[model samples]
Target chain A: MESILQSLISGIVVGSIYALIALGFVLIYKSTAVINFAQGELLMFGAYLCLTLVVVLQVPFWLAFLGTLIAAALLGFFLERLFLRPMIGEPAISIIMLTIGLASLMQGIIHMTWGSETRVYPAIFPVEPLRFGGMVVSQVYLYSVLFAVVCLILFNLFFRYSSSGIAMRAVANDQQAAQSMGISIKKIFAIAWAIAAVVAGVGGILIGNINGVNASLSSFGLKVFPAVILGGLDSIPGAILGGFIIGLLEALSGMYLDPLFEGGSKEVVPFVILVVVLMIKPYGLFGTEEIEKI
Target chain B: MAVKCGVFKTTYRDDEAIWQTKVSKFWLALLLIALLAFPFVFQGSRYLLYVVNSVFIAVIAAIGLNILTGFTGQISLGHGAFMGVGAYCSGYFMTTLGMPFLVCVVAAGCVTAIVGMIFGIPSLRLKGLYLAIATLAAQVILEFVFVRWRGVTGGSQGMLVPPASIGGLTFNSDFKFYFLALAFTILTVMIAKNIVRTKPGRAFMAIRDRYISAEIIGVPLFQYKLISFGISSFYAGVAGSLWGHYIGIITPEHFNVMISIQYLSMIIIGGLGSIHGTIMGAVFMTLLPEVLRVISGLFSGQYPVLVNIFGAIRESVFGLVIILFLIFEPDGLAARWKTIQNYWKLWPFSY
Candidate 1:
């Protein structure tokens, strides 16, 4: 019973980061209708950028975090202007391939800037474990959960009240209709990319708290696909919920099923769930069904 | 030279037409005969034969992938996994049950077809990026299986394939494997060409252009789409099996997402729908990385950062090439090259 509770707590901690990262992915997918295969790489860049500022430049951690977030947001905006803007009317194939190219481009840039060695990120939070009843949680993990939830709440408020946020939501619903209602689809696209990068930045810092920092963190982007798909593409809240669900499954599978299967099947469990879910529920948990015209 | 000018002039029926054109048939036939003879002429140098064998193998995979993505407008990003599926299946059957090599090939193709169908079921409803996601999930799942199922797949280390034989003679020599690969590729391409010209092929093309309109016109969505996946997977499976046997070993790494991307690039660079494009795309891309490697090695000493710039150069250049091709020459390197050749052929006369 204690072990399950520990698993549950640990799962939620990791899931919080996945949820944040997936939220970024969902935001971009919402406005553009293109899956940013580069989202993982973007998170890695943000974390690495923060590390560079904090460790190399001797900047304070909070300052580095702010700087990295802005830098990543700018990078996202730049990508929107240069690569994605051209892909607006192109076939679905081109948009996908472009993002893949962007992903590859980011990978190369990351490799060039920071050699692919794993780096130890300095922990900002207290090192002590917080014990409550029969369970104990690491301070950094708890901090990560708190930080991500706070960021998400702020984002929720921004979307609920801000003009740009409402416009972004309008574009996500129908680009043509949104434009007819006097919303600038182009600006919405840029804002979505910018917002996604900020979310990714937050996700990066939190993930660094838990997983440490490395180029391999870009792999989490691929893992986030299962989470987003499970959560439904159109629903932001679904992304958050799906992230925890996927994270819990990963933890559970890694513990209980990994031993039985014995060959690292747990890593693939999310995908199995994703394919099965997509096959059964093409619209996902909260996705609206799109009607196509001939 | 009493060539079949009657069949060449004005136009010819599909059955009566020469290989491409009247002038091309002779060149192609000579090319084929020369290709067949070159390995024998090389005094049995195995390495050259191996590369030749791979080119043919990649061709088979490319053609299969082309059918799905190009003809049916179904984007499959996990063909590498399907290829892996075929390879592992064939390798397992041959090594364990002592199945005959021919049977192993057939079984490999069949198993992958079944797996492709399983993957394709979701594809019936999904399109665009969603469909790509569905196929990618298959790739991920298969990669998991490859790493986990040590009993069946030999785990991450993968499995060793035995010398394949027809009846009794084993293909231990590279020349033999090359011949087998060449024969398989040619046969596969021939079959694919015939398929794309058929009524079902027309249906696939129709569906690709617009699915809803095609559906309204009485095209059966489930049947033709499944047919495309089935046939495409069969092609990928055959290619994978050939690749396994030819390489004399198989590993999970050989069929990663990058391999799938390479296949996609081949069709994109070669021209999406054209058979000529598929063949040229495969040949060009299969050789490109090697060519780039050798060429880059010449300059690496001058630029210490060359190694660092390698992935970047390859990626950005690859991307730029794709985008440029799409904008300037969307017909692809094959079709554009053909047009240039035709201009040269008609030099001195203004049409």
Candidate 2:
């Protein structure tokens, strides 16, 4: 029972980070209707940038964090303008390939700049473990969960009350209607990309704190697919829910199934669930179903 | 469609000829002769033979992927895993069952086709990105199995495959393997070219353009989609089996997500839905790294840093190339080839 509780708490901590990364996916997919396969790369790049700032250049942590977000946002905006803008009306496959190519490009750049070796982030959270009712939680896990929750709440308020956020949502709903209402679709796309990058940056920093930064960190973006798909590709709340579910699933599988399989079940379980989910509910838990007209 | 001024077709059979023009036939025959003479011409260079052999294998795999992604418009990201399935199957058959080389390749292809069909069942319900993600699941699952199933797959350490042999003849050297790869390449290419021009091929195109309309028009969506998956995986399996025998070592590492991406890029860069373009994409993709290697090798002596960073540079160049191609020439090299051909055909007289 204690072990199960431990797994559940840790799962939520991991799930929050997944939610943060999945937020980046939902953002671009919402506004631009293009799934950014490069989200993990963006997260990875952001983490590496922050790492370089702190470890290599010795900048203060908060300053470096802010710098990383700004740089990531600019990178996102630039990528959207240069690569995605031209592919606005192309086939779905082309857009998918474009994002995939973007992912490869970022991966190559990261590999070239940092090499493939894993690099540790200096501990920002207190190293002490927090105990509650026979369960031990790391300070970083607690802080990351807090950070994710705050970010989610802030985004929720932004979408509800902010004018730019409203405009972005309008574009996502109907591009033509939004354009007619004088919302710049191009600006929305850029903003979405930038915001997604910032979100990804935060997720990256969190994950990097927990697991360290490496080229493989880009694969975390791939993991977001199952989460985003489960929650519904276009639904933000669904992404969060899916992220939590997948996180819990992974943690539980690691604890229970790993010994049975002799290991590696955790990595494969989310995808197995993804396949099952796709077969049963292709639109996901909260995703809007697309209707086709003949 | 682009017939010469004087030539005219009198029957559907004449129009449906694979070589539509005398000029085309002549060029094909010349190309074949050149291919046959290639190994002899470069007999001294074992490296060149190795590269060409690998290109042939890539062409087969690329053509397989093109059948699914290009011709049928069903996106699959599990192609590398399918290839791995073929390799392991063939390796197991050869080592444990003591099967003949030709039989093992065919058996491997059949097995992969079934596996591919099983995964493709999701296509009945999913479309576009959803389908792509499903294939990604297949990739991860198959890769996991390849690593964990030690009894058959030898686990992550991988399996050793014996050199291919037919009676007294063994393809132990690159020279011997060259002919084997070449024969399979030509056979598979011809089969693919023919497949694209037939009824099923047209059905694939119809589905790709729009599945609802195709279904309304009496095309069986589920059946054809499964057929596409089957044929594509068969080709992948054959290619993988050949690759296993050629390399004499089959490992999970050879078939990774990156390889699947490479195959996708080949079809994209070569031009989707074009058999000739698939070949072009395969050759270009396979040779790009080799070309990069040669260039970097030349500069390595001058700057030692170039040696250390060559891999990184190649990866970046690969990504850059794909991005540039998607942005500038989305239709791919096949369309460009047509334009060039038309330009030359209408030269001097001009438009």
Which candidate ranks first by DockQ, i.e. highest?
2
Candidate 2 chain B weakest lDDT stretch, 10 residues: B1-10
Strongest candidate by lDDT: 2
Model 1: residues with Cα > 4 Å off, grouped in runs: B1-18, B37-48, B303-331, B341-351
TM-scores of the models, in the order given:
0.93, 0.98
The residue-level lDDT of candidate 2 at B274 comes to: 94
Superposed Cα deviation of residue B135, candidate 2 (Å): 0.7
**lDDT tens digits, residue span A1-294, model 2:** 989989988889889989999998999999998978899999998899999999999999999999999999999899999999999988878888888888888888788889889999998889999999778889999989999999999999999999999999999999999999999999999999999999999999988999999988988889998899999999999999999999999999999999989999989999999998998989999999988887
**Tens digit per residue, CA lDDT, model 1, B1-351:** 432322224445655452656557877889899988989798557766766777898899999998999899999988999999999999999999999999999999999998998889888889888888888888888887887778998988879998788987888878777788888888888888889889999999999999988999999988999988988898888889888887878888998887887788788778888787899889887776667667788999998787766775676566556655655665677788787767756654525
Interface quality of candidate 2 as DockQ:
0.77
The DockQ-based CAPRI class assigned to model 2 is medium
Superposition error at B278 for model 1 (Å) = 1.5
lDDT of candidate 1 over A32-141, digit per residue (tens): 88888888888888888888898899999988988998898898899899878866777777667667767766777777788777877786788889999858888888
